[model samples]
Target: MCSLCGVLGCDDHWTSAIARPGIYTRNTDRLARRREAANRIRLANALLEPSRLKIAEWQGASYVLSSPTGRTQVFESLAHLWPEVEAMTARALDPLDPDFLERLKQRIEAAP
Candidate 1:
């Protein structure tokens, strides 16, 4: 149930809609989609951690981005993630910025 709407709802993002083997197909398995969502969250968190922020799956409908201080914003699309993150962290976050990419590369190299 959504904390705001108090109802179970799905706001499927387009990225998932275009996925191969189709989550919308009649025979699609729920577990596979769950795994994909979890994987996406894990990978994004790896990049987000340096900013002291995290994201959580919100009833499989929307994403809940949070700051270490507990501030949170719920968004239904990845398009909204950057602005919400920047608001929470008070820092501009550009995935394509060369300095940011260099930092990401260094983090990957340092990770186990």
Candidate 2:
């Protein structure tokens, strides 16, 4: 009676081919995790936008910062990427923080 049941239960070659054991579920889970990570990154970047900072993935395990000047700085650790970016944005929001860029560079360089 369900729409999915009707389509999946139908005698169709396409459905049969894709309905293999564990294939659909495994792929769905992987895609869902990827989507969730992407969404988190998007939300975090949105928060950073007002501070003139943006975080982007440089490679699978690296993150890059896009500054207002169009300069890019790549950090080689995923573990410290978000925290460092958040810290930078927090400091950047304050007009008194003239050392934010230096601090960001130090933090990224120190990240393992």
Displacement of residue 103 (Cα, Å) in model 2 is 23
Off by over 4 Å in 2: 1-28, 86-112
Give the local distance difference test score of model 1: 0.73
lDDT of 1 by residue, 55-111 (tens): 987767778998888888998766677788888888899888898889889988998
All-Cα superposition RMSD per candidate: 3.8, 15.6
The local lDDT score (0 to 100) that residue 58 gets in candidate 2 is: 42
Best-fitting candidate, scored by TM-score: 1
- lDDT, candidates in the order shown: 0.73, 0.51
> For candidate 2, lDDT tens digit of each residue in 78-109?
45655676565555254246565555556567
Per-candidate TM-scores read 0.75, 0.45
Error of 2 at 105 (Å): 29
The per-prediction tally of clashing pairs is 0, 0
